[model samples]
Target: MRVTQHLWFEKDMQAALHCYISLIPGSSLDWQTAVMADNPSGPAGSVQMAGFTLGDQRYMAIEAGPLDSFNHSFSIIVECDSQAEIDRLWTALGEGGSYEQCGWLRDRWGLSWQITPKRLGELMSHPDPAVAKRVTEAMLKMAKLDIAALEKAAKL
Candidate 1:
């Protein structure tokens, strides 16, 4: 059995796919095709099917509708190299969208993303669990995650 992310877009599947691929490193769009079928609402061929990669994960995007709702329970987390990288990603993903604290943003397409720095994990995984918890608490209070601050918290 294989698992892949299936994303539903209200109208901009291609735009969302491209935007994600652009922000993510080493990512690419693999295929796009229209599937023809006979059904209600619109038609089977009404859907635009796309295959893309985000980091190492595979995802499929469909622009078929009967517009639906999206919520916070699902999100894509990107691990970055530095604060600069996090900022870059946050700005790109947050354009035309609102920002929330702790390195989270909702993209224009209403997709939630966590633009996290790679070192944050190492800092939070320090030898002392209390330090790690401190780092976690520090992270929870910030909008954009700062690697330096996280490291400082771990050392405390």
Candidate 2:
């Protein structure tokens, strides 16, 4: 079975889709369609829906009006293999957006994202509880994750 994430946007669906597609590698916009009938968001011919893929994950976004909006309750996590990758995504995604502690950030579109390093899991799951705790504490103190600092906290 295939699962696709559906996102609701009040407007600027195309711009948001383009931004996501541009940030992710091996991503593309599949299609977009306008509403054929009058809808709550707008008149006929307004953007109704758009399909896009980020990496291998499929997502559909609808311009369903202000009836719904994004909140911190849900977020997409991007796992990075290296510090460079994490930095790139963090800098790009945090543009015109606010940064929160523990590598969390809100994009310009108000979508929440976590730019995390793969090593974070490894450090946080160390066999020694002390090491794991240290790493966790270190992570909690930072807005953007620092891989080197995390590794140091893990004493690795």
Candidate 3:
């Protein structure tokens, strides 16, 4: 048995999947198809469905009439290897969207994402509690995560 993250979009499943796959390496659109039967969600061809892999994470998405939009409770967190990676994803996802503290942002499609650096996790999990606390404090102050600042906060 396997589990996959699922998403629901009003009418932008294809566009959102393409945009998301473009930002992440090793991601791909596994398959997509429209509903051919007269389903409750919509008539034939009105609902679109897709299955994809975003860096080994399987996701299933459907573009049907809106039931519930994406909220911060469910977010995609990209643990970036470098500041450049974080910045690139931040820009791509933050455009025409809203920014939140501690590396959280809502993309144009109303999907929340966390563009965070891998270093942040290392710092957050530091053996020394003070170091981890400092890193967390610094991270809480920023909209976009900065690897340098976080490292400095770790004092390592």
Candidate 4:
């Protein structure tokens, strides 16, 4: 059995997918094609579908005109091994997008993403409740997550 995360975009599906695959280390566009048969979503050739992979995950997306808007209900999370990686992706994905508190942001395409350091999870899972609480507080105050600052908070 196979399950893929399917996305519906009103526009810019290919551009968004290409940009997204470039950001991830082991990602690619598996296939893309335009529909020729008439369907409710479009007059026929207007619909476009593509399958892709981000790391080991499979995803399919369609450009079938506006059926609905992307919202907070769905988000993609990228956990980085270093602050530099987090910073890089944060800048790339957050460009021309809306920034939200605690490592959350919406890209120009209106897709939400979480760019966070892997260390954040380790610190949050610390045995001491104070450590976790401190980390949480620090994260809440920032639009982008900082590993150094979070570690310092956990130490306090």
Worst 10 residues of 3 by lDDT: 7-16
Candidate 1: which stretches are off by over 4 Å? none
RMSD, model 2, all Cα superposed? 1.3
After superposition, which runs of candidate 2 have C-alpha atoms over 4 Å from their true positions?
none
Question: TM-scores across all candidates?
Answer: 0.91, 0.94, 0.97, 0.97
Q: Write the per-residue lDDT of candidate 3 for residues 94-150, one digit (tens) a residue.
A: 988899999999999999999988888888999999999999999999999999989
Q: Cα deviation of 85 in candidate 4 (Å)?
A: 0.9
Q: List per-candidate RMSD values in Å.
A: 1.6, 1.3, 1.1, 0.8
Model 3 TM-score, 2 decimals: 0.97
Q: What is the lDDT of residue 133 in candidate 4?
A: 95
**Which segments of model 3 are wrong by more than 4 Å?**
none
Assess each prediction's global lDDT (C-alpha) against the native.
0.87, 0.90, 0.92, 0.92
Better of 3 and 4 by lDDT: 4
Candidate rank order under TM-score: 4, 3, 2, 1
Task: Name model 4 segments beyond 4 Å from true.
Answer: none
**Highest lDDT against the true fold, candidate:** 4
lDDT of 4 at 139: 92
- Model 1 scores a C-alpha lDDT of 0.87
Q: Spell out the clash pairs found in candidate 2.
A: none
lDDT by residue (21-127, candidate 4, tens digit) is: 99999999999999999999977788999999998889999999889889989999999999898888899988898889899999999999999899999998989
Which pairs of residues collide in candidate 1? 101-143, 102-142, 102-143
